[model samples]
Target chain A: MDFLELDAVTKEYPNRSGPPARVMDQVSLSVRQGEFMAVLGPSGCGKSTLLQMAAGLLPVSDGTVRIAGRRIIAPPPEAVYVFQQYTRSLLPWRNVRDNVGFAIEHRLGRRRAREVAEAQLDQVGLEGFGDHFPWQLSGGMQQRVAIARALAAEPAMLLMDEPFSAVDALTRLDLQALILEIWARRRLTVLLVTHDVDEAITLADRIAVLTRRPARMAEMVEVGLPRPRDAVATREAPQFLALRRRLLDRLLLRHDG
Target chain B: MTAERLLRPLPGLCVLALILGGLEAAVDAGLIRRALLPPPSAIAPVLWDMLASGAVLPPLLATLRLVFAGFFIGSAIGVAAGLAMGWFPPVFRLLEPVVELLRPIPKAALVPALMLFLGIGETMKITSVALAVLFPVLVNTLQGVRGVDRVMLDAARTHGWGRAHTLLHLVLPAALPFILAGMRISLGLALVLAVLAEMLAGQGGLGFLILDMQRSFLVRQMYAWLVILAVLGLALNALFLLVERRALHWQPALRP
Candidate 1:
């Protein structure tokens, strides 16, 4: 059985002066255990909405999201959501260390949580910057703190919604490399949503292509790439180019329509 | 950095000196009546005498006591109510109409009503100050709590933080700038209402003394008390600014 399953998921929002408007249409996808799956789509697509549903942060209008064979009603303890807007997501009042500790501080006392946060920070290459506030760090560093926070939760799954889209290109590449390393080390199931074609192919074990608004999963293409991917070499390969072209063409078709 | 900090206020201090000098010149030249406005030099000695003789302590402490009690009580109630109203829809709906109606009527006008109920005592005076302090704080805190980023709230939920934990750690801190801004405005109102209540009640604080001295035609003493009140206001405002900057040190725009 899939580790996470979205079964015939549909989402609708109440309109100001009309019937409910649909944003996601009967989308169903499944993520296997220990897989790095990327949900790629055009801008303003309901990819993030689907990811939120799978994480159980949003109530599904007409379907069930099951994690570990259990129907998800709220955020399950085995999963954590990493937000794209790291600046807003992090508590500015908290130092980098405390923010990372936020995930486990309730279970573990402050002292124990801080120690765990420090270890997570080290993994994310943010050692010795624990005392600094989020505003004191650069955009990339702040996102690293956010990633550390997600990792500190020690969940079997990580749900990320366009997590690195806000940083500079060079910073984005660095983050991409960092994520690949983390994934290899942790062997955690990841469902990352993104609008970037290159990012989807570069990091994901499989790419789930999505259609435009009121979107549904179009197809799931296996990346079939080797483990421990490099930023430059991975992109330069033939398979990466072929997969990028196929996904871009599919997405562009919807854009043209 | 120390030099920069010291020099920061030089321009404002210079302007203040120029205004005081101009007022003194006008009074000395008889263009302004000394009976109406005492020169800085004349009031300076009286202020020094009051301070040195420890006569400044009583009235100063009394007024300070009223302001502090009202400000703290009012701020605490306002924050609690505001967070509830902002966080929970039912609470907001229940309180919205009553708050809007009560908020607009000047709290000073409520002073007479308060005096009628509580009579001319410290209770009446502090209550009046608290009423003045409450609404601004309540309104600002509500705004702040409501304006908290939705993403952050979602983050809190995903982290498995319960409602109480979220309110105390996440929601409260996120809304702090708004809460503090409201409290800053209320601090000034707290003092104003305290002084006003004291005068109206014919009480023993600085306000009453200023009024009493003027009526008795002790012009110098009245100006002297007025000067003390002005200095008190300036000191309180300076202290609040210092604390506010420190509390919001992490905010980039608020960094000192």
Candidate 2:
């Protein structure tokens, strides 16, 4: 059995007039344990909605989502969603350390939670900046704090909804590398949703191509690139360019069509 | 410090001194009647005498007690109700109509009924002030809770936080700016209502002292009480600002 499964899941919002608006249609996908999967689609393709459903933040209007063979009705404990808008997602009142530790607030006492948060901050290269509030940090650093916060939950699966889309290009590259490294080290099952084909090619084991609106999985492209990837070397590689070209063509073709 | 910093308050201070000096000269020249508008100097001396004789403390303390007690009670009820109404649709649907009906009716108009039930005592005065404070706080808190960013709530939900935990940690802190803003407005209203209640009830408060002195034709003493009230208002406002600065230090706009 797959670690995470979305079997013909669909999402529809009720409208006051006319037919209900559909966001996802029969979107079926299965993620294996420790697999890094990226769902690539056009803008407003309901990719975020799809991730929300998988994270159990939104109810499935039809079908079912299962994690570890258990049906997910509400937010599942073993999964955490990293939002695209890191600045708004983090609690403004909490310092970087406190926000990171917020996940374990109920499970661990204050002291233990702070200790865990500090350790996570250290891992994310924010070691001495624990006392600084979210607004005090740069956009990239704030996103890093958000990542650390998600990790603090010690989730079995990390659901990232266009997580790096808000940063600068240089910062985006750095975060992409950092996330890949973390995934490798932790052996985490990650479902990253994005419109950036290059990003999908860079990090994912398999790229799940999605249709424009009322999204459905169109194709699954296997990324044959070797692990322990380097930013400069990986992009320069023939396999990387080939995979990037294929994914981009698929995304653009579907978008234009 | 910069030259600009040094001269920041100069214009206001100069204008105040000029006004006081002008008023004193006008009164001495008999252009303005002393009985109608006592000069600042005469009012100052009377204020000093009242403080020294310990005559002001009882009324001042009474007013303070009413304001604070009403402020706290009103704030507690307002925040609790606002949180409930904001988070739960059922609660909002049930209470919204009743709240709207009561909100527009001036609190002073209810004083007669309140006095009839509770008597012209501490409870009546405090309840009047509490009613005055309640509306602004409750309305602001509800707006604040409703105004909380959707993505933040999504973040909380995705983290597996239950409704109670989410509201306690996420909603409350996010709504703090609104709550504090309401508190400041309510603080001023509380003081106003407390005095109004005291005056109407003929109770032992600064308002009563002012009325009592005026009836006896103690013009300077009445003027002195007015000064004390102005100072009290200024002091309360200053204290509230201090608390606001400390509490919302994390807010980017409020950062020093």
Candidate 3:
């Protein structure tokens, strides 16, 4: 069995004054144990809605989501989400360590959770930021702290929703590298939803292209790239450029149609 | 130093000093009659007399006690009810109309009705202040809880936080700023109702002291009590601001 699975998942949002809109239509996918899959689509394409359904944040109108052969009714502690707005994600009342430690303490006991949170902070290269509040940190640093919070839970699956879209391009590159390093080290099954094609190409093991509103899986392209990939090397490679061209062609063609 | 830090409070202090100095000068020069506007010198001596004899201390203590008790009780009920109403659509729809109906009725006007049931005692006085203070805190709390970002909520749920856990961990922390703002407004209202209750019930408080002095034609003493009330109000406001700053220090500074 696959590490994670989504079977014919459909989500429809009710409209009071109009016909109920179907956001996701018979969406289905699967993730292997160490696979990093990126779902790429235009805005309002229900890529986020798909991610939410997988995380069990939203109920599937008609389908099933399973993790390790077990059907998911709701979000379990083993699967965690990293949100896009890192600044608002962390509670303003809590310091960095406590925000990370909150889930740990709730899941584990106090003493054990604190140790795990500290270790996760270290893993994210945010060891000294434990005492600082979210507002005191820079945008990139805040996102790292949020990543640390999710990592502390030691979840098997990590779901990211446009996690670096709010940061500057330079910071986004740095964070992407950081995430890649972490994913390599932890071997986490990751499903990232992003509008940035370059980001999807750079990070994902396989890219799932999605259609616009009432979204369906359009295509899936495997990225056969070596580990510890450099940005310059990957972009310059003939195969990488070919894949990028192909994805862009698919996207622009969809737009024109 | 920041420009705002230096300039923000300057005009307010200047206006307050100018008003007090002008009032004192007018009274001293007989431009305003002594009975109508007692000079600072006269009022100072009367205030000193009351403080030295400890004539005002007991009632002042009693009034403080009542204010705090009412504030705690009313705030506890308001926060709990507001959270429930804000979280559940059915509960909100049911309670909103009743809350709106009762909110506008003058709190001071309810004093006579309360006195008939509880009599002119501590309960009546505290109840009056509590009723007056409850609405702002309740409304603000409800709004605050409702105003939490839907994105943040989804993030929490996706992280496997249950409904009850989300309320305590996410909703409460996010809603705290608005709740504190409401509490600050309620604190001032609490003080107002406490004084008003004393004045109307003919009981002993700073309000009663002012009334008694006026009846006896002790105009200077009445002015002195008024000064004390103003100071008390200022002190309470300052305390609320201090708490607010400490609690919300983690929020990033935003340009207005």
Q: Pick the candidate with the highest lDDT.
A: 1
Would you list the clashing residue pairs of candidate 3? none
iRMSD, all candidates: 0.8, 1.0, 1.8
| Model 1 / residue A191 / CA error / Å | 0.5
Q: List, residue by residue over A104-148, the lDDT tens digit for candidate 2.
A: 876786679899999999989999999999998999999999999
Q: Give the TM-score of candidate 3.
A: 0.93
lDDT per residue as tens, model 2, B114-180:
9999899999999999998898899999999999999999888877777998899889989999999
Better of 1 and 2 by TM-score: 2
Candidate number that wins on lDDT, 2 or 3:
2
lDDT of 2 at A80: 94
lDDT of 2 at B150: 94
Q: Write the per-residue lDDT of candidate 3 for residues B102-182, one digit (tens) a residue.
A: 999988889989999999889899899899888888999999998999877876776667778888878988999899889
The local lDDT score (0 to 100) that residue B88 gets in candidate 3 is: 81
Q: Estimate how well candidate 2 is docked, as a DockQ score.
A: 0.81
**Pick by DockQ: 1 or 2, better one:** 2
* lDDT: worst 10-residue window of model 3 chain B: B247-256
